[model samples]
Target: MFNQRSSPDKLMRIGNILITPLLVIMAVVGCTPQPRSVDVTTNPTPTKLVPDMRATTTVIPPTETLTPLPPITLDARVAEIEALMTTYEQMDLFSGAVLVAEGGEIIYEKAIGYANREWSILNTLDTRFRVASLSKQFTKILVLQLVEEGKLSLNGTIDLYLPDYTGPGADQITIDHLLKHRSGIVGEPAVQNLERIERDYYTQEKMLELISGFELLFEPGTQWTYSNFGYYLLGVNIERVSGRTYADLMQERICVPAGLTDTFPEVTSDIIERRASGYWFDAERGFIHDSPLDMSFVFGYGHLISTVRDLYLFDIALREGKLLNSSNTNAIYEAEFRPIGDETCEAYVVEDGPASINGFRASSHSYIREDRFVVIVENVRSGGYYLPGVFEVGRNIAAILYGCPYDQPPPHVGD
Candidate 1:
């Protein structure tokens, strides 16, 4: 059974097959895919892809006559994913970037739509967008690295490292609780509901002061509420314990070693080249300009800005166990994630995880078992709620890649 409430374990639960790691990353996190020849960093660009549209009656455009697929090489299964993208972009459902890799090679990648609509700039492979809670994975790695270095203990309380933190559950909250979001640090009702926060400029000191005043929602480790404040404290703890700035530690520990050039903490004051403008999509009013958030507001929870290529390199490095010792690398997979949905196929099952913030949604879904996966990061999202987001796109993409069943969206109206 796919038990969402079960204790976190090392079990690799696919639709039906539960298996072991590596050799078995062949399944990634779902079903096994027939082996294909590919590996990390191998990108082959084909000038033209004959679209292999499937799912609910696909229509070939009137202008282009369908060439008979070469019998020698049937249309690539990945093309179905491209067809899906065309459908999404036509519907104004997705805009940003996507990269897909399998058997260790990048099979497909593309940048779609406008990066900055005002200037009419197009999104490119190198475009940088705020990654939101995806930053937590780096925080998780840093915390685990500290454990490996004997500088911190997962079971240890936050008070051990940062003595000045006077939050409600400083003594009761374990570092483990914080990492898992089991920390009970509840923000003010207004912050929790995200009212007028986008317009406020928060400095690090002021943000910490705000966190200091937070009260716990429940006893530590007894429940989960996805506390950004808990993660902010972890960042503060990392700085306090390592005596290095978060940016310095990240660049030294993860980016430099992983050969990641474009991944870094966000700085609102600096002009970040190729940074994409985020927008809110309103069906009735069209695209509304997304408000700028203080870098401090994002803080430890979602502060990093990166591109698809850099995100892929980081995934390759981490899964190859280059980022941490074997134990911690495996821990990344085993660590509990707030379950995505009741049925497994409905979610991307990101090895690092999936997240959204304002105008952006990011997912790093890997078939570690099949050595296959999809990475999606986009700008422009509905202001009302989450959904019609990348999670749906990635799930369908994975299904196409693995030959699993998935519904391809029908063509958009009047296109």
Candidate 2:
């Protein structure tokens, strides 16, 4: 308090010294660096965490491999065929019975359309139909059987069997020639006259007499022409050599051995059960009753009636060698005999055998190497004409079995 009032000059000097030191302290404090501002938008570096040293290694189990399925079997093929035929039936393109087999086992079977259209009788598996030219196959088999029994010789001339007959080329034509269609006998006349004569019943002798009158188309074995007369002559030879009727021999030697209960020589006059009435396809009328025939006129050429089941049995018998030995079967399949005329002969091989007549069609295919076969019989003539051909149906079925492409039936042309 007493020294509060100091001299002006002295007070000024003290104040200056104090103020200078304070200013220097303030500068030093301001110069010191503060904490830098952080940018919140920038990503910060991740913190590395030390893994636990005591942890065990992680393991992954492997995936399992799956097994593939087996291939399509005969049974499965049967189902496929069933579906296919059902489709055809819905289209009204198929009628009658079809039977397919593999290794002598039935794979597929079906009956479609009507056995008697007028009565609206649906066809059954047991329904019988005329096998038409399929009878030739049976006749051929019978001839081969006769050869085996020493009752006939393939090389023997027709004259050897029918010595009393003296027709043109009959002496020169051999059994083999007739069987192979190499006999140059004219067939057109007989075929053309069938409609006229089909109504009349003829005995074997009378039938031969009628055939003998036809002129030879060419020298024996010089050309090929289908001759029902040739097969008819074979039937006569079978009768003369075996001392049995053709029907009797067929029953004992073929039908009985093959276990074919429904196969027999057709007797037009005899009333038969489950017989299919034949129908012809008319472009305008759809389906009409087939022209009447005596059945006897077709004779050994094509006069047998059978069911698909029976035909299947016959096919099985053939493949199992129950009908003929391997040698004879081989000859039947492999024998090469050419025709003599300019007309090419379409020979029936073992792999494919087809037969057709007025209102009946039958097809048989032997896939011998594969042990598979198929048989199709249609009682209606125009059943397959406008759509799939009768034999084409069999081929299409085969293509399905083999997993191959097949042509579909054409669209129906008529209403």
Candidate 3:
């Protein structure tokens, strides 16, 4: 029985998934101010990747086939995802980047339309985008690492580390609960003070204070709710146990082993050579160009950025057990489901599945599956509201990749 009301903190805003200009600009400045040494390890393992090229620079003559696979052969699945991009781009509905991977191979990779409309900066396969909630997976891995090291225990109460925290359920909430969104913590009120301050520019200490004071929404471990606050606290726990910053942990454990050069925890302004600019749309504000919200509060939960290629590679690594141990991995996946609805209604399933990675339109935005994963990224800010579309885009791509029918639909991810 999943608990419908077991909402985690809202610290994770939607913008984390897609990098907005606001976030990029703020990330650039925020990272600059905090200077820290990052550890870089060299892994001799080499990957069998197709020659990497910028989609923006590559000229696929209009008459040239749009196949992104080997020997220029087109698979029906790849063709459909390509066609969907064409249709969506024509409708002016989507303009970002996407990649679909199966068995650790790129079945399809593309960047459509404009990354930046003004300078005519085209989107590219290497161009970076904010992966909003996608960052949570990284956060979860860090916490699991701490658990493996014996610095923290999943069942250990939160009070073990932060003796001063007096928030409701502080004594009862465990590290496992926080990771699974079962902590029952009501997440936003702690930030009322920083609400006046811009999220990106705020100091880390202030952000912690905001989270430390939130009240409990339900008894610890009662149900599951997607709470950014729970994740943010997990970040704090990492800092406490590792005696290092969150950014440092990410680079050392995840990025280096995966060989993801374009992905990083902080954002900087002087756009990387192949970075895309994000745009927002509104009724009154037709197209507002902005950076991703600088969320110091939810820094660990959703403050990372990466390109589609790197995102795909990282997902593959995690699924293959390159990151965490088997027990921790199982625990991490198990934390996803929280029982919801009444007896007559079905309990919400929270397992990571193939459906979660499908672009934006799909409903379970945060889910990641075992075999195939699709990442649909968008650039337009107004496009943020179309996250569900991103999921659907992934789903459509998945259908083609797995030889499954998109219209036929598969099992519910949560179920």
Best by lDDT: 1
How well does each candidate superpose onto the true structure, as a TM-score?
A: 0.78, 0.76, 0.69
Candidate 1 matches the true fold with a TM-score of: 0.78
Candidate 3 global lDDT: 0.55
lDDT of 1 by residue, 1-415 (tens): 1234423242223333222322211111111112221112223442221121111111212222323322321145656666777665555556788888765566778777778888878788888987887898888888889989999999999888877777788888999998888998874343754647645778667777777776678999998887777888888888888999999999999998777899999877889898998888664566777666767677777889998878877877777676788767766754222222222222224344457676777877765544565788988877543235566576677656544444544333332
Model 1, poorest ten-residue lDDT window?
24-33
Query: Where does candidate 3 stray beyond 4 Å?
Result: 1-47, 50-74, 188-200, 267-273, 290-292, 333-370, 383-388, 402-415
Write down the lDDT that model 1 would get: 0.67
Residue lDDT tens for model 2, 1-415: 0112322332212112211111111111111112222111111221112212111211112223423223666556666666677666766667778866654455567788877778777888888988877788888999999898888888899888887456788778999998988887656355566677778898877777777887788888878887777887777788888888899999998888778899988888999988888888765577788778887777787889998778867766665567788776655444211110111111111433457677777876655434556688887775424644556677567656654334554433242
The whole-model lDDT of each prediction reads 0.67, 0.65, 0.55
Clashing pairs in 2: 222-340, 223-339, 223-340, 223-341, 224-340
TM-score top scorer: 1
- Per-residue C-alpha lDDT of model 3 across residues 1-415, encoded as one tens digit per residue: 2223323331111111111111111111000111212111111222335333111111111232222222322355566666656555544555677766544456666677566678766677776766666777888888888878898898999889766556788889999898888998765543454434443565656655655666677889988776777877787778888899888888999998767888776543344556566666553545666534554644666566677778767755664567887655555444232211111111112323221111111112112332344566676644323222454465455435433333312222232
Ranking by lDDT: 1, 2, 3
